[model samples]
Target: MTHSRRSLLAAGATGTLALTAGCLGFALGNEPLEFDSDRVAPADETVAETGYEERTVEERTMERTEEIGGVERDFEASIWLSNYSKSVDYMGQTREGSAFAAVSVPGMEVAGQSVNPLDEMSNEELLTEFLGRADSDRGDIENIQQGESFTLEILGESRDVDTFVGESELEGEPIDVEIKLTSFDHEDDLLVLFGVLSKRFAAESANVELLMESAEHPIDT
Candidate 1:
């Protein structure tokens, strides 16, 4: 894990303690439910039309054990992620830029504790956690500058998102990347959408937004 990721997680852990006290759904006898990775990804037609190829669709889980009453209890959260990429000509060379969406829901396992981690997190915190969990293979994100706030539609509902600019190494070259991140409650799930665009082409940023706007995994798929 990178230092940035560790720091974000540490901050979240402390915030969780204070937020859980007022969470109405905190460990309300709900069983943890696993979401289907296939359904969380954007539709095939959507990707094809957007000229992006699917890279990965998988469930990423985070497990933790907490000591309560001198006994150890285990808890876990399942995060469904769907990644996609597209090749573009940048400075006369073909380069691949990527984007992805990750979704997590309530009802995370709480063992004997009354605090549900997901329920305790706000949308901004959820976005931070999702960004922190980015794969190391994607290169380390650095010098993040938070940008504008805007509204976008996801799962048919309007959501507010914050934009950010960051630098990352892409194939031995430094590339400026734009990130649009948002987290919000939708129906029964906490939906987090993160779109990354390498500023190789002028249209790449718009493409990233299109990819995110088209994100969806049917419940039955």
Candidate 2:
């Protein structure tokens, strides 16, 4: 019941990433639309070609409360999602699919009082948790750099987010990642949300920048 190799890295490593399609040209608002499970019907060719199950679609909506610094932050959002699970499937021994995106209520610290989603784990922690296993083709550890936390207007509110991007080799192949973590305003937790794209999708630096700048929420306008 495994999805794919990248999917496992996506979950165990950096939390779930998100793919975006404008939710079907729907206005980016708090509106629950009908999502047919059949839309994600597995392609017969995909199953036949890869010995994998066809992906199915599911309507997903959720809400959760995260505690940060003894305070509560509430979050909610909905999307059509697919699931993947794998174990020792690669070559009957190697691995893979999914981690859900995270959402944080937007807020910032004031008067030097700390208030952001659970402090984002340090880059070192992230490396251990996510990229520690990468095998650089270069035969040396890839250079990783954590950017400073910054704020931008997301969903009509000012928000703070931490970003990280690193390079490495996995099984002798190159691996590069860019992650953006954030905390909600009214809570003390941090989350991974908004969107994710492969190098093919994010070919331009600007596309990656856009994903880091945008976000999703259950907020009704």
TM-score of each: 0.68, 0.33
How well does candidate 2 match the true structure in TM-score terms? 0.33
Model 2: which ten-residue window has the lowest total lDDT?
2-11
Candidate 2 per-residue lDDT over residues 1-221, each given as its tens digit: 11110111111233322223333221222332221111122223433333333233344434444332333433333333332211223234443211113333222222233233234555346334433222111233345567676776654677776665665443455756454544342222233332221232233334333443443443222
lDDT of 1: 0.58
lDDT of 2 at 52: 31
lDDT of 1 at 57: 63
lDDT of each residue in 1-221, candidate 1, tens digit only: 10110111111333332223323232232322222222355567877877877776666666555543343434455556666777766568776666656565444323234324666765556656777564424577788888888887777978787888889987788988888777765544566677777766547666666666766644453
Model 2 residue 215 CA deviation in Å: 2.5
lDDT, candidate 2, residue 20? Answer: 34
Lowest lDDT 10-residue stretch of candidate 1: 1-10
lDDT of 2 at 61: 39
Pairs with backbone N, CA or C atoms under 3 Å apart (clashes), candidate 1:
39-217
